[model samples]
Target: MSAPPATSPSLVLAHPTLAERKHTWTLTQPEWGTALTLEEYLHREEYLTTVPLAKHGGVTHWILTVASAPPDQRPILSSCETLRKRALYSTTAPPGGGGVAEGIAHGVGSVFTDPAYRGKGYASRMLTMVADELKAHQGTLMSPSATAASSAADDKRLPPVAFSFLFSDIGKKFYASRGWVPHPSSHLSFTTLPSRRSSTASSDAAAAAPPPVAAIGYHELAELCTRDESLLRDRMSRLPSSLEAHQAPSSFASTPPDASRPLTYVALAPDLDTMLWHLMREDFITTRLFGTTPSVRGAVFGHPGRRVWAVWTRTYQAAPPAISANTLYILRLVVEDESAGEEYLAEGLRAVIDLAREEAAEWGTAKVLLWNPDGEVEGLMRRSGLTFEAVEREKDSILSLMWYGDGPGENVVWVAGEKYTWC
Candidate 1:
């Protein structure tokens, strides 16, 4: 259906008040509450609000509604949330200047519309207003209607963000039509299967020559995440120079080098705060389901000088018939020694993946998924004797993005489109 006029008097876009917030939560529970009952889901929403990233006005809830709707009636035609996320941007040195700039990217999620309002273009109108608000904050696309809807106090508290993104569950066309172009959405999936042999003998022998994988708990991630951030910054900083040689891969800098325009690379920093937010959500669900939280946050391998590590989170679907499986996702995978030969890299990568498989089995999750594996990871799947399948996800969790304002132009490459990047 065609969206209503952008400036229609019948519709308004603004931040939801506390009551409206809870109302939207209640409205969306049946669709996204998953394994939790309504009470548990409400509590879960409360729990998430306290996380490091969600606190300090880092999250915003938005709603679209008829302006004339009565206060007694919930006027939310469509609703969604945006997370202010840390992202890195670096541009090509013009003659002799180049450095990384820290910025915020909005991670959009929990998009929902009441079933009664489905296909009425309410969501489209809501997102258009949201885009206006985001771009306005960026000091661009400041429509009078969007500006009037937001308060001056809010503008002071929240800085201009660089871009906004959402993982689309309903396929690319819908969100893409609204300016969020699709990013790479392929992932490698490994289903957990029953062990073929008795565990006693296998366990004993495995202990003797266990894979190099070592479990990393919550406390250990901060330092590593900091280090990873530095690594990511360095990679993005060098991306422009690499583009000159055509050496940078699409996963890192997908845009083709256009000499006329200075290239800019943007990447979400895989920092502790973001990782913890993902884990906090997972831990909440696991605690509700199994009465315990996962102790192994991720796995690390190799010597301290040359390490390969992976961090992951658990996804639990509503009890049976949901079609979507409960899965373990590798939120971020970092390999320190890319110069290390393919065979050596593959060995280390496979060891980490093996750890993920075992963790999935232990957690009773059906699959382990990794997004956008580079050539090296693909080599391990082919040569390491591990059974796996690659899939291009067309429906759920398709990564999508929208650049705001006069920002990084058409060639802005999104690095690190990992599971952790999702809200």
Candidate 2:
């Protein structure tokens, strides 16, 4: 008779180490979407140690750890590369209050376990540990990147617990079992954005929270980016625009990369190759924020994390579209905390335009081409000598500050597999 399957907890759980390469399993990120490759893991010690500090303004690390080892040899087991985006978003004011939008919101970017180690408790343990890190410090909120299904519990003002995962993932069972719940999804929609919860508030939860800050290594950020060069480019490249759209429109619940296989996988799991793409189509991973390096980020918007309303190109298939007199379009700019400054905003508007003109001149462009703003952003743009040109879309009053831009927030696309688990 065959041996029966081991219970989930039977799997071994331990800190990942380089020595465990032979026993470790893995998941590799494919070029696009969320394609993963599972194999004998290597460099098991690279977990958080090798993480590169993203230049744009966050911590980008590939989470490859040791879930468990073999039974007889107890081979040290390593797992796949699961991308984790852990940014401790902070401001002078507290978050969700009327202050300067201070505090920390830690996103798990993505988590992937090992294939050979799956079905055990490796993922759960890693996740729990990571969550603890997020929960540390005062003024910190536990907004995990859950699948759409898992996000159903908490208030939407909190980050989406579901991430882009469809209601199908139903991962809330995991977090819920641990005391967290789904946040609202309605508030996350493009339209009907809710006013940001004030950043200043006094509560026990706030008091116990860690000082929000997933500080990135600026040195590393500089190493991984191409910011200055972008000053010469045109419109920023958009994922949906560059790659093919989904055949059957789906919700963020899908949580995988787009059907087209994203060049970058915003993986939460170990194996990037296994996660389905159609799910993560709406994910912010492929946007200017998360996936692109610093150079690309700097090239898209003069500032990193400055989510633009829209962009365009004069010709050619690449991004950083050429800036030219012939090319004209209206745009929208939404600051995360408009309350932060009235004078500063005015100053910023002027600075952005002046900088743009300087770059345009360098790009051999003349005239302001065409520019327009529908809302306050229009006024801000005009401050820079820009004016609205045409209508991209029209609708009765539009929702304001729709996204937290990177516009590309981090998210999990896949897990290495049940094999990587260690309970």
The 10-residue segment of model 1 with minimum total lDDT is 138-147
Query: TM-scores of the models, in the given order?
Result: 0.86, 0.30
lDDT of 1 by residue, 158-276 (tens): 44567888899999789888888777677888876443233536657655465667888998899889889988887777665444554434542223335555556677889999999
In the range 395-416, model 2's lDDT, one tens digit per residue, is: 2111111113132221211211
- Identify the runs in model 1 with alpha carbons over 4 angstroms from their true place: 1-7, 68-74, 93-95, 136-160, 193-208, 241-260, 319-324, 405-409
Best by lDDT: 1
Candidate 2: 10-residue stretch with minimal lDDT: 414-423
| Cα shift from native, residue 420, model 2 (Å) | 29
